[model samples]
Target: MTADHAPVRGEATGGLFSGTHAPATVSFAAVMFLTGFAALAVVPTLPSAAQDLDGVSLYPLVAGCFVAASLLGGVLGGHWADRAGAHRPLAAGMVLAVVTLLVSAASTSIWHLAAGRFLDGLAGGMVAVSVNAAIGQAYPDRLRPRVLALMSACWVVPSLVGPPLAGLVTEWWSWRAVFFGLAGITVLPAVAVAVVLRGPSWGVVPAPSGEGAPRPALVVATAVSLGAALGQYGVSGWDLRHLLCTAGALVLVTAFASRLLPPGTWRAERGLPATVLLRGLGSGVFFTLEAYVPLLLITERDAPPVVIGLAFTGAAVAWAGSSWVQGRLLERSPRHRLVAAGAIVQAAAVVLAIAGTLPATPAYTAASAMVVAAVGMGMFAPSLTVLSLTHSPPGRQGHASSAMQTTQNLGQIAVLGFSSALFNVFLGGGAADAVGYGAAFGLLLAPCVLAALLAARARSV
Candidate 1:
């Protein structure tokens, strides 16, 4: 088929898993499943690992470091994908994951665990951006939505199985066993995928390297990582030096963030920039609110672990179903309208969360709110991705993918950090824990509203 006449979802000709691309599609799905499983399975074990390594005080760093390091990884991955092809970086990221898991598996100290997580995040970030860029390059425009939806669906099985399996492994054997087992299982499949997808016809052609000019992208990427790390450290401590660290982090972010995003991204310029900004805004609110879900349920409502688990599982299913809905509507509906509608749903979810704080509210009220909000995430996340890929000019898809991922990381950190700080302040001030939860959810409503308002800008005018 010619590039001008491409196959789309629901076509009589073929689906996403058909033709010469079938092997690559299957390989991509396999690796995605592995990565998703690893990502979720490891989370529930982190508390045990932290206590074992005496890193309980620095527990937040474990997750924060991953987000911080992923920024650099995303930048490097995008540059490498553009300069060479997505295959090399994707393979490297997979290998890097194996190595990092080994490090975590062998860790005897808190710093070692942190180092492993940081490297794992870096590798995972690279893998994610490269996969997005690769999909954009490999698939026809019409099929992109279906492919992205498929990627989201890959998380469903992981969400269902990872936590319980990890808990069982941790209880029966050891946390290290989980890491070692994942690393061992991922190696052969990752290597197999790399070998299968090494052909030049995969559609990712290398861009010309500029003649001896300094790599501005690299500089900006490094600055973002440093800023995130410094910011994390500042939040971890309460001393004077921590305050200085916060100042330094802010300076780095202010100075370098713009260099990484689209020119008018800071101003929410229409089209690509607005698309990227909306991704950040939507992700920021959802993730920040997600972090507090378990806390509110456990502390305020006395929900059990099984109930908490059920809430997350339901959200995962809802997210997948919503993604499927968007894919089916790709031809019938416009992206901007879907995004705006999704954002409104997100806002409504927040309101439900706030309402859940009432003493008379049902026990599942907060959980229901989270699941519904995830539907909003499901609707818009893939749509924005498709927009980001389509809006980019030719070889710059890698850069566009990197920008989206970077903003996502930054959004999670910044919004969650701010909301967490607010929650802590309220708690310290002797406010009831329920009051703190309410205040934090109230604060989250602003970004959700902003994201909805900006969704129109994601469309081509």
Candidate 2:
């Protein structure tokens, strides 16, 4: 069967693997790596940026601006690509990202850093959509799950390491070095794309129908994501006002998203509705638990940072490996079993997390809980992604992908925000010094419950 997007076989040109990567695969990975670079690398160095700016006060603005801009970029990039073409948008965005990295490295003031981060994030958003859409078009159906899983793994590996390396550069050399280093790392991906995927086979974007109203929903999702992100940087300067802002942000986000999705989806009707819900719930529970477990180990259980880092490493690697394995293993499984088992495993991990907390030893408890959470998350994410894409129509892949990501962004905000408030209510001022360390860990159940509910809906779907 001929593909609507690719009229010619790219095999005639430089293949993704010329030796290793097929042209499409290589190009897709290149884009995914860029997305990972921004998501993972720049975040940890914000403190150094704050220090370099010579005032701690500007830190919140620095982080928020980057996130806000990225949100906007995601909307623009997706919409523009749909109107223009993926190849040009991705190519131009990469160049822009590279230039911004240089600007980030050379920044002399907070404003400069903010500008650079914002630009960098903008490029990141473009990369996320184009690369993902490319993968959807390029890979065979049987291989798509693995390809997406690989993309997820690339994100996980770099995201885990980018922060620490950013911190190290800031500590030993300068935060600027992290930016410069990222700039240098980008060359490979950019070069690969230019060399390997430069043929006529890849299609530009199709024009939007009518006014493209679905895009507004993505913007709202970004606001929701921004609200959740704001909570993490609160140590720099966030409070009740920020929290309240997030609440309002989420309402708008939800309302907007409701419009973009297929009718009755927000309510999780059969088929695609349930798929979107699964995407949201899978991510929501995983991160809600993730955000707090380390703190529990360090403060409540009194484990050291090194041990905590190891616990995280375990979760990350496990997640990555599971994503890879599922790519190979689940090709034959019914979407129903694959999706349902992934959900059940992830929920079961939350139960395991509860059990881990029951143990008194911080080291043992943290390790056990993290392993469970990581494995569960690993199983859930890629599988859910596959099911979501599986049911999407060819032309609607962009809309569906955006909807999935949009749901995830909202999930992070709504589930995480609600969980934080729950944590404060359950374990407050005692956690003022403690940061709600242990009680925060308990919020894993919310997402698990949500996921289970969605999984049931998925079965019927």
| Model 2 lDDT per residue over 183-280, tens place | 88887777777555566555643434552424554456555445434543442323676656655555555555565455667678877678777777
Q: Choose the strongest candidate by lDDT.
A: 1
lDDT of 1: 0.84
lDDT of 1 by residue, 1-461 (tens): 65433332122255677884577678778888899988889998889999999889888778688889988888888877776777878899999999999999999998999999999999999999998988877777777788888889999999999989999999999999999999998898689768976775654553445422123556778898989988877776667987798889889998998788888997899989999999988898888767888889998999888878998899899999999999976545888888998899999989988988877998689888889889999998998998898787656778888889989988887887677778878988999998899888888888888888998888954
Q: List the residue pairs that clash in candidate 2.
A: 15-23, 16-21, 16-22, 16-23, 17-20, 17-21, 17-22, 84-205, 85-204, 85-205
CA deviation > 4 Å runs, candidate 2: 1-21, 55-70, 156-161, 204-240, 352-359, 427-435, 456-461
Give candidate 1 regions above 4 Å deviation. Answer: 1-13, 206-217
